[model samples]
Target: MIPSLIRMARSRTYAEAINLLNTCQSNAATIEAIRKSGGRMNDYAIVEMNDYLRRIGYVPDDLNKLNVVHITGTKGKGSTSAFTERLLRTHMTGRIADVGLYTSPHLCAVRERIRINGEPLSEEDFARYFFEVWERLEGNTKTIYPHTPQFPIYFRLLTLLAFHTFISLGVSATVLEVGIGGTYDSTNIVPKPVITGITSLGLDHVAVLGNTIQDIARNKGGIYKAGVPALSVKQDQEEATRVLAECAEEARTSSYEVVPMIPETALGLRGAHQRINASLAVALARGFLRAQGKEGMDDALPRSFVAPLAGTKWPGRCQRVEQGKTTWLLDGAHTTESLTSCGEWAWGEGNKPGVLIFNCSGGRAGQMLLTALLEAGARTSSSELVELGKRFEAVIFCTNVTYTDGHFSSDLTSHAIDPNDLSQLATQNQLRDAWLELVPGYDPKQAHVVASIQHAVDLVRGMEGEHEVLVAGSLHLVGGVMEVASLQGSLGMV
Candidate 1:
């Protein structure tokens, strides 16, 4: 115990703890294991995380006291979760002490993934609690079992930490965004969420989640438990919708309803797709408020709910900014599905000299994303849709890595890309080649590939004349831009 205590105490700064956390990041080996097994480890992982929480002095019932709204889906889950938090915080004024939000793959800081009342935990608080959990788990590992994982995986630990933080802070409510597909996700360990939502299911994480949309929907349905209200946007895939309903029936859910898009609800988040996300949020918030005994919650989509829902601010999703001569349109859309919406939003914003600054991690479908972007842009116009694609003056692809020396920020460095790939510029070159193939006669000079994010930003920032820069594809890439371009403090992207 003394050795464990010393080890934990050695990380005297938040930066040190972040570095240590990055080491726990899952590598290619883990991803390969998930792919081979089809990521059915959801149940096993929940049991594992549950045991970890117990070892750290938390039980399902203990966490249950902090009423939770658990949300999971392929896309828009993060944005939906953010909307629910704001509405709950506003509607439940004086009714709840704090609203704890836990989402994944943060744009800037890992701490940004866990926020209390829309603000990240301070560096001091993060370090203090980080070691508190780390030391406790270290000392109890062998005592709990002869063989256990050295520590919880990164996402699982962060989930436990969010629960721990909320419990320690005595928060009244928590809004959880599922780390992955539903059924066996760690967040599913909760005895019962007050309400659960599936936000627009699509074909994503096909290898780990499932091969088909129905399989993906079944896994997402894992979050539904007996007696909890289940809400969702009626999916376009009939089979996926049927499977989700079957799961709800199997769990004997309190109520399973398919919500419709609310018309003319001006959203704080840009794009037409956000209306669907907002609609789900409105339903989830209404269900949550009703559970808390707040009256006047009905199908009308309350007049009071309008203000708070519109006030919600989630960055890196159709977000816009003006940095001097450059206009930055940022959206963390990596999957083909979301990138379709992203491209539509970006192209609709302007038909000017634009440069697409893009990169994707985690084996994302880069070519499919690029194709989707062009297709979406073409769809937005009838007369000269081809002309819209030509409006993009340049296409920039680069690694999400911040520095050329192969060092990543303490919080952001956990990548699965092999060192060989970086040296060969495999990802960027693939993107560049894909762009060239998509555009016949496109000047190869118009497509630029840089070794690091800073270099990409420097090149574009130095470009003469007015420019529209679309930083799309991955949140990591958008986040790297924030760090290199000094947008974190200047724009408060965090």
Candidate 2:
């Protein structure tokens, strides 16, 4: 494997890196493993990830040296991670040299998942590090981790590459967001993040996770390492709070503090829920700074933290993008709770007529998300005005398949959808039906479906007059539309 790395290092261009990646990527195998087990989180993912890391000459301890700020939750993980990274960079840029950010589900490019100093790795650097890790594992999969997978799955590989890049670049601080629920998550292989945090937890990923909020909280709390400062947002329910405390004790961390959400906190991101996320970010930043042995890193958020927290900009989360004929209120809120907030944020403040551009990944929660959005917009009583439902005249559901050719961008190609869903338009149709039920008298003609993102953009482009289009439900959908609509290269929307 070492020899393979040396050989690939000779001339592994970006194209070859992508080819190797496509050949190696496989979610079907994991899905099959889950199906065989009747669908539960098992040792398979944990063993594969840790074994693969060991093959590439990395261990959990090595990752700990990167000074990680690990985070997980049902929502706001990315925004909290973003704020943590930006805030750390504010004080640690010159001190730390480089701050590595490892996140998941990139908007457009896989490079977006592995970043340093606020920018995604360059094509040349990404390909270099990508193949360096790939070939090393490829060479050893047959022998070193003989019983384990020869190549790590997509996210696992990126996780390895992120650690490699950060270490190789001499990074002093790292921000890590869990790819899934924390207990068996690929990123959880890191044993000792300097500070671990759980943002808001909710009933998301219920099939793999358990059926209840307490179940989800325990799973997310798995990132806590003993003797580390474990922080979390204050849970709304007593059971959730109890489960979090139990998990904290189970993990036996040095201390646990549930940071309270500040009321009316100014945040760069839209949506009211961001105030809590911002508060968590503030706590994480303080913990990270204190870990560096920096003086004045006391309990309070430094006066400097406010500007970055309030001014932080995380792309595509409740962002507003205007192009040509429409104003896009873009958010990647897929869960019921977040989507409810998105609906209120979209309709509660504005009076202009809206057109909803919505799609969720194939999940059981699709109907629930749609219901939450509609309820958010609907009036609870006769005297109360109906403001939410009246904002949108059109609701479009489209597959996140980016191109008219029915192919996705290289980075996005790994999002597995059942072939039947693609052929039958199963999920999109499900959303359309749900929309009809929510708005009883609205014309079925208002609910539309398109083949690809290009078709969806064209449908919006053909609309008459000014319209506020709420692009919600999936980040992939928003990113696909942005790529097709030529909004990616625009100014000041981030």
Candidate 3:
């Protein structure tokens, strides 16, 4: 083992463990491997995942006892998982001891990814579980490729940790969200889930999953298991719908159903787009109950379901934080479809938008994201255009780096970004130029590109008066904004 891995395994505090965990993430190497795989990455993903799971003392079959509701999609997967977990927690009260939720790209802390009964694992528990997995993997001496790192990467390690945490906690039900595409995601090692769900599909993650919507659908459908009931939100694209149906058939799912949108209801998560997710969650939750021989609730919105759905608290997505004079609107909408919904939600919050803080991960289409937001704003406006020049008093584009010191928080550190791009502010500059071209009348002076999320927040804070600050684009960027802006308090109910 590497000396650092030994020290990381022996971390005494949650903070220390988090720092150590961050070091395990080999994003650059992972990207390189993916590139070299030539689109055949998914073939080996599960075989390797199973080996990692076995190294930590579990098998694919062992996870079946967790009664998981596996969920995946290009967008809305997190929200859908949140809704499903919340609903199950409420509906299964007393009947089930606890519910486990594991999602990705946590907003504030790494512990947010693993929750028990809607609460993030306490720092003590997180540290305890972190070391438990670390020690197990370190003690094991098995490897398919001895040259590769002995330990799994950050996400795989976390997925193993989540499984260990849930099983150790004796949780009866678990909601598992895919970290990436479905078929090969670390969470896909679950041999059987009570039910599986897919939210709205889009062309995100095209490079790895394939550039077409059909490819994305097939990659997502990898979550579907034989004899499992599979459900998805009604897709807008006919190609996606057809592909998903075919995938379900190929997987031999007990049944395949498309969930229709729920009428505008009192949902805890904001945005019109959430209704789609909410509808899917309802189906998954209900299907889980039936699969477990708990209850067969009909399509009608029962009080048990309604209350949890209303009280569901998904932080950082369509959230509004009121800190004195500033009303901060935060949504981690990285894809164009989700960003359009985010834009609509922002416009609905207020017409007099204050500052727009935006940043997408490297390689994403910044202009397309901006266009989605602007187009959504245009639809809600009576004018011909959303008048980007006046709508947003100022537009700030910045890197996801948490601080101006050119460092990321331990949990927020990302190695996937291109080093050259980060040094040159390449993506930020492109976004700025895209904005300038999109709104020609907009004053160049009003547009700013900064180095870090802290710089963006500082710029917003330096501005005078109370205004609505809309922060959207990448979830990492949103998480950075929450950290620097001290909006962590709004993680529950904003």
lDDT (Cα, tens digit) per residue for candidate 3, span 1-494: 66865775686689888877877777765665653332247566678889888888888899999998999998899999989988888867674448999998899889999988887888999999889888888788678665546777788889999999998888989999998778778888888888999998765555433467777888889899999999988887899999999999999999999986666679999888888889999888888887767654865565568888999989989888888878888889888888889878877746456689999866567887888888887776544443654667899999988999999988788887778898999999999999998887888888999999999999988889897888988888989989988888776521
Alpha carbon deviation, residue 289, candidate 3 (Å)? 1.3
Distance from true location, Cα of 13 in model 3, Å: 1.4
For residues 160-252, write the lDDT of model 2, one tens digit per residue. 888889988889899999977788888887888889999987655555334577667777888888998889998766787888888889888
What root-mean-square deviation over C-alphas does model 1 reach?
2.5
Model 2 residue 344 distance off true place after TM-score fit, in angstroms: 1.9
| Model 1 / residue 86 / CA error / Å | 0.8
How good is model 1 by TM-score? Answer: 0.94
Candidate 1 segments exceeding 4 Å error: 1-8, 32-38, 41-43, 95-97, 143-147, 204-210, 350-353, 381-386, 490-494
Candidates sorted by lDDT, best first? 3, 1, 2
> What lDDT does the true structure give each of the candidates?
0.79, 0.76, 0.83
Say which candidate scores most in TM-score: 3
Model with the higher TM-score, candidate 1 or 2: 1
After superposition, candidate 3 runs with Cα above 4 Å error: 32-42, 95-97, 204-210, 349-351
Which structure among the candidates has the greatest lDDT? Answer: 3
